[model samples]
Target: MRTTRSYLALALAFVLVLTGQSMALARTAPGPDGQIVLCTGTGPVAVLVDDQGQPIGPSHICPDCALSLFQALAETAPEIAAPTSWLRAHPIEFTLVFHSPAPRPAVARGPPQAA
Candidate 1:
């Protein structure tokens, strides 16, 4: 009877661990809106949301581009960029929002001289 109880306890513990991990994964998963927001900077920072109004994640930016963005933000808003000292420090939050699709840029026509 004691051995059975011990086995059951071990099983329960394993199940609990698995449940916790799954919950964490779910939180990180993209929602129906497919968006995630991260808070960036010290305070009162602004983040651009996508067409769906979802806050874009850092992964969307390439490493080199991200660095450039950080530098630019630092110059414009030192307080916001201060948290970027850490390699993984992301000071932006992505919020899902609704946006009308943007129209494509118009193509330029031939020069007047050619007409």
Candidate 2:
């Protein structure tokens, strides 16, 4: 019981951390045509921007990034504004996987002695 509760607490903490990290950045990101404002690795990137639609930091295009919401929605489907042909070139794909806890091994005990 304790282990399960601890695991849940740990999971909650992790979720909060991730949520906070994502919220730290502005909700807005450059549109599909929008360029990269600033990025660290080839994966996740945060394109900085001022009130105006202008790059406040170093902005560039991420070639490694398979796809972004703007691109996917713009090209694949008509969710946001008009569709874009550019997203066609740079396709984006997102995958989700589910994980399950491993079963605990059965404990062994010696035969009970006669009372």
Candidate 3:
């Protein structure tokens, strides 16, 4: 009986650790539009804006990947707004945004080479 109990406990612990790891990988993001967006693992994503079209803090459960993206955006887009109070009260919506690299302008060919 003692051996059986010990085995069961060990199995349970292993299962718990696996579950936690899975959850960490799948981080969740919140949108201000009352929607929850989950990081499906594509690239850096942004949170949706609320009714006022403003960014909001993540919901209670901040996923690891989502947090990383958020921190990056916060550094660049400091002007981005968030609904702190609303997020505190309601569940946050996590969404993904696809961002493309900006194109560089071509250099002028010396004032159009007077033909």
Q: Give the candidate number with the greatest lDDT.
A: 3
Expressed as tens digits, the lDDT of each residue in 24-112 for candidate 3 is 65454333476545566796566756787666665445544556776676746557677666534677899999999999999866656
Where does model 1 exceed 4 Å of error?
34-115
- Alpha carbon deviation, residue 106, candidate 3 (Å): 65
List residue ranges in candidate 2 displaced over 4 A. Answer: 27-115
lDDT of each: 0.64, 0.63, 0.68
TM-score against native, each model: 0.28, 0.25, 0.25
Where in model 3 is the C-alpha error above 4 Å?
28-115
Q: Model 3 compared with the native: what TM-score?
A: 0.25
Q: Please write out the lDDT profile of model 2 over residues 45-81, one tens digit for every residue.
A: 7665555666666543443453564676664554577
Model 2, C-alpha of 69: deviation from truth (Å): 18
Relative to the unseen true structure, what is the Cα RMSD of model 1? 23.2
> 71, model 1: CA deviation in Å?
53
Question: Which has the better lDDT: candidate 1, or candidate 2?
Answer: 1
